[model samples]
Target: MNLFRLDASILPTTSTSAEIADTVEAEWAAAHPGATVTRRHLGTDPLPADAWALAATGGFAPEQDRTEAQREALGLATELAGELERADAVVLAVPLYNYGVSQHFKTWADLVIAAAGPTASLLKDTPTVLVTTLGGGYGPGTPREGWDHSTPYMERILRDAWQADLTVIKRELTLAGTNPAMAALRDLADEQHLRALTAARTAGRALAG
Candidate 1:
């Protein structure tokens, strides 16, 4: 089996989403000792910003008439799609930044979609796990309820567009103790983190089976 893990947190080591994903990956590794694991650090090595645009427009031109930049974009899209096609399962650790989606992730997604083209449905049915972290509470009943715009976009793209068999694990209130405004919610944050980590491990084991 092969696992393709994509980490989109700029703070690599200190990222809660990545840490939780580590738990899931650990369980996956334990279940499949010899399984191959591919890692893509989108935060540190984001795809070219212009790649998507070049790809989108290049499709209308003949390959031989494409500019060098367009050729590179098409090549990148092909590579990105190939990674997903090769993986038995996919794990994505993406964090909400400034109440918005990560541009790096969006670029990757765009490239993949471009590569898939008319046969996009071919990307369906794969088991995919998405781990997301929010600095503040955004769930129902919270003061900022309905304020999360990242999760819904991710779900629409991954589950609705790609049609992957998706499983999402979220950890909210991450800045409770660190941020003065949320100091009183420290305990809730800790509890949420623990639950999220436990769920991540459980999901990994189930996927391995």
Candidate 2:
């Protein structure tokens, strides 16, 4: 079986999102020994910022008239879409950045749309695990309750758009352990961490099965 894992954390070494994803992956690997895992790290090797525009426009241009850049962009879009299309399962490790999606991750999503069409279900019926982290609490009643603009948007794309059998594992107050201002919430953060890890294992077992 082939599993696709995508990570979008600028800080890999200290990334809670990645840590949660690792738990999920470990469970899958244990269940299916020797299974192939394809990994793409958008934070370390981001797509070209302008590729989406070129690819989006390229789709309208006749193949013969497309410029070299547009041709390359379109190819890249197809490749990104194919990675998702071919995966038996998927794991995405993304974190809230500035209260929204990271630009690079956004670019990647745009490229997938450009290649697969806005409504294409590239992962139709496929199992997908989405692991997202937040530095602060944004649940209802929190000061930033409505400030999280990343999760809903992603769920729209992954669950609604792509039609994946989606499972989301989200954790908040991730900065409590590191940020002095959030010192009082460290216990809550640890609890969230454990919960996320447990969810990952459950999700991973589902993927393996």
Candidate 3:
């Protein structure tokens, strides 16, 4: 079995999403001993800003007529799609940035779409776990309810577009103890954190199966 894991946290060591993903990956590794893992660290090595656009344009052009830039972009798309096509499972460690998806993650998604072409379903039926973290709470009944623009978009792209067997694990209130405004909710944050970690472990085991 092969696993494709993408990490989109800017802060490698200080990232909760990465930590949760680590647990999930560990479980997957345990379940499938000797399984190969393909890692892409998008946080530290972002995709080229124009890769998606170039790739999209190249798709409509003849192979011989494509520009060097377009060729490069298409090559990247091909590589990224190849990784997904080979993986039995996928893990995405994403942290909400500015209340929305991280730019790096979004760019990678664009490349996937371009690489897969219009009719090819490269990720169809693949099991995928999304480990998402939010510094602030956005659950229903919270003051910032409906403020999270990332999760829904992810659902649309990963589950709807890619047709993957998807499971989402969210860790919220990440800034409660550290942010002055959220100090009062520190206890609640800790509780939520523990729950999230437990869920991560559970999710990891699921991946292995």
- Give all candidates' CA lDDT scores: 0.89, 0.94, 0.91
lDDT of 1 by residue, 128-170 (tens): 8899999998988988898888999998888888887889999
Q: How do these models rank on TM-score, best leading? A: 2, 3, 1
Whole-model lDDT, model 2: 0.94
| TM-scores, one per candidate | 0.96, 0.99, 0.96
CA error at residue 182 for candidate 2, angstroms: 0.7
Model 2 lDDT tens row, 1-209: 89999999999999999999999999989988998899999999999999999999999999999999999999999999999988999999999999998787899999999999999999999999999999999999998999999999999999999999999999999999889999999998999989999999999999888
**Clash count for each candidate, listed in order shown:** 0, 0, 0
Clash pairs, candidate 3, are: none
Candidate 3 segments whose C-alpha is farther than 4 A from its true place:
none
CA shift at 102, candidate 2, in angstroms? Answer: 1.4
- TM-score head-to-head 2 vs 3, winner: 2
Which candidate has the top score in TM-score? Answer: 2
| Better candidate number, 2 or 3, judged by lDDT | 2
Residues 1-209, model 3: lDDT tens digits: 99999999999989999888999998889889887999999999999999999999999999999999999999999999899999899999999999999999998989988989655667798889998999999998999999999999988888888888899999899988789999998998899888878888898887777
Models sorted by lDDT, best on top: 2, 3, 1
